[model samples]
Target: MDLSKYLGLFVSEGGEHAEQMARELLQLEGAAVAPEAIDSIFRHAHSIKGMAASMEFSEITELAHAAESLVGALRPPRAGSVPRATVDALMAAAERIAVLIRERGRGQQGEGKDLTLLLRGRAADPWSEPVAEAIPLKVEPAVSLRDRLRTVRVRGETLDELLDVAGELLLETSRLRELARQAREPLRAALDESVDRMHSRLRTLHQRVVAARLTPLSVLTDQLPRHLRDIAHQLGREVELSVAGAEVEVDRAIVDEIADALLHLLRNCIDHGIEPPAEREAAGKPRAGRLRVEARRERERLILEVADDGRGFDTKKLRAGAVRRGLLSIAAAEELSDQESLMLACLPGLSTSDRVTEISGRGVGMDAVKNAIEGLGGTLAIESTPLEGTRFVLRLPLNVALIQVLLAEVEREVIALPISKVLAAIEIPSGHGRTFEFQGDEAPVYSLGSLLEWKEIAAGSAAGRPVLVVDGGGKPVGLAVDRLVGQHEALLQPLAGPLGQFPGLSAVTLLGSGRPVFVLDVPRLLEA
Candidate 1:
């Protein structure tokens, strides 16, 4: 039978086996030898070698065979203990197999000679080249940042400065269009069309600049497994860390901004939540605690959750601790809801540990984590149950450069409100009162033109007018407009130079008709 039809199955199964091999190797380090673990790995490697040999992939067959021998040498009837070097070499071989499997998945040929020699005790020096470096990962030559980074390093600031100048020049062209509008109607229309064509090109350039700055979440999470292993070793704890959805890409600036926050949260989980191996066994749980880091995309936002199956602290204790530490008075602590009390853990100088350690328990880690997330226009939430578990959730924009905006017409001037911040959009009938009932309470509504006072226009006696329910810092507020212009995807371009002087506007965008529209910073506008 021809083996060509089984290519996909072999690659998929080979990948899973390699992953199991890596995890088993990680378990062997800093722990007692287990013949069962070695046996399981040997079986997986043997299966891979058999499949590769059937498929006539000699390079992969040789690599898997070498790794199988290494694992077999550490099993019973031959050895009683596992050598550290064997585990290291086997781990490298597993890494090589994983790379080779990925190449098979992508229809590429990869050579694993260096790692195969290192595994079978033939190479003079094992560390001369890493498995990841043996065969370079393929990437498209054009537009791939991997190719560009290999030759040159560019700073994000320099990119932003160039974009700002380009944006300013675009605005200057808009000013010139105003002069053209004063000429004859025929000549004015021709000039407007030319400007529109020019604007289209500039917008494409702006989009490229924005995309070039995006960083993959994998870049941020690539070293997480090794980092978690090192931290577990330091804390003298047994933790199994698993990560998911590391392929999502986001603004590089957001990645840099939240890197420390992610680290602090991870450190907190290991330092405080997980119990010692003996304590965990006594508590009727597994000796090793489970820690999960997951990232997923929902609409326009990236939701990141870090959860741990360990002993969670009590919010009652947090409330009492707040009172004891003098961070809050007795009455204030009593009035706080359980969720609010849970957040008090982020307060400086408030820690659950009885003694301070270098890893955490100084009380500043959570505070910094919260602040960093909030600085990126994201919210951080905490949920825990006593003696059960704790989960920290971060909800942030997937792309800060682009936003889904609700376009509305106010006195004939188009405006936008970020959809992420809007609660709902509704229609009001004619003869309705100024106060609309929402959630059993009356929410005061005002016309958008009345609030912004632009051209002193209003939607008086009009029916089917649009009203937006916006989040006004915990409470909802109603803002009605003359008409609904529907929703649109827009780039939140910078307002530089003369355009920067416009108050109460967060960003601006150009419509398909070449008309410029401003985004209302609703809270700021209301405050002013």
Candidate 2:
């Protein structure tokens, strides 16, 4: 029987088990052992052991057995805190397991196996050798672990292919709908209804495909605590990190990109935003600073925030730094709002740190983070208060594959505006076209067609034209279009090659009429 088919499954489950075990062991450090946590950790170790045993991976089995023994010893019929030394040993073991699982998954076979002594934080080979040795154990082989298939995991490439097929179907459906609308008068009604039904079903399929690709942010964030623990010890900073709403799901692509962005934010906060324990205590703040990474859902978007409660950003210092670096003139720097000034931290190479350090003194990470979020069709906002704290807020689309867009006409061209970003669609009478009268503020209005350099069809028309009320920076603006074409769902396709080089365009999608239209990055469009 071939075992290659089972390799992906073993790696996936084994990796998860290793991470979970590490997380639980982290909680046991310098704290009273919770019976449930210990039991959970023990079960995870036992599962890995059994799985490895069934696969006849002697090295993994031995390592897992040693880890299991340590956890089993800690599991209570007795009551006492797990020793810090024991916790470190187990943490190392868990990390070793994760490394081994990843290596095996990548098709890396061991040079050889050497025993790892984990329980005592002693190892014959430091477990650095692939599938190195570990303490031996005698336990019945539970190979049934091989037979239980809990979930069918699909490769990311397979999903991407499915999405491509779906996108093509979307275009075809749109083409069919247009053909239906243009059909002979006698047959139009039935054709229209049939096409609409197909559209509905296609939408449901698109949704399922998108949902299947949703990944909980927790998978990337769960390791943050352990990382923070390690970094705190290195930095001499006492910190309490709170991670919330990591269960919030987002497209897998976003999650993957955000992993680095989140890490950068965390590292920045710890190295710069967070003050030393002594400094914090001297400032009438708690010795341990508070850091939080939180995620929330708002309609079709996800809001992620990373914050630190330490010595906050000093806008004056930021301004001075920007001016010193020639990124901004002295007058320009002074003219900036405090909020804008604080954002200077994102300016490349503009560090306010008194001395340069490998951790963060070079101001590069924030700008990279900003660019990354924006590339994902997201926005990053910076907030800071002197002596208070600094928070970075990122608002990102839930799924980039399927987008709900408000279609509008500009002469013969159809363009898409992300519906989530457009506050409302209204029509202003011919005479009032220059100003947008909302619930009741007058905002500057620009003809969308004119902005696109198209012949303005809405110009001088007796009848009113459609205006998409949009958030222009922080103020309201009216974008007048030739006409409102109703809302439509679009499959966002990446603009490959040179088409991707254009500014003010986020993505392009094909309309039912077989028209290719660009989805405007509203803010960028307005700015451009």
Best by TM-score: 2
Model 1: C-alpha RMSD to truth? 18.6
- Backbone clashes in candidate 1 total 0
Residue pairs in candidate 2 whose N, alpha carbon or C atoms collide under 3 angstroms = 114-132, 114-133, 115-133, 115-134, 116-133, 116-134, 174-512
Off by over 4 Å in 2: 1-151, 179-191, 411-413, 422-424, 434-444, 449-463, 470-477, 485-487, 493-504, 512-515, 523-528
lDDT value for model 2: 0.76
Off by over 4 Å in 1: 1-184, 402-416, 419-427, 434-466, 469-478, 481-528
Whole-model alpha-carbon lDDT for candidate 1: 0.74
Pairs clashing within candidate 1: none
lDDT of 2 at 193: 69
Candidate 1 TM-score, C-alpha based:
0.56
Give the TM-scores of the predictions, in the order they appear: 0.56, 0.64
Query: How far is each candidate from the true structure, as Cα RMSD in Å?
Result: 18.6, 18.5
Candidate 2 global TM-score? 0.64
> What lDDT does candidate 1 reach at residue 119?
76
Relative to the true structure, how large is the alpha-carbon lDDT of every model? 0.74, 0.76
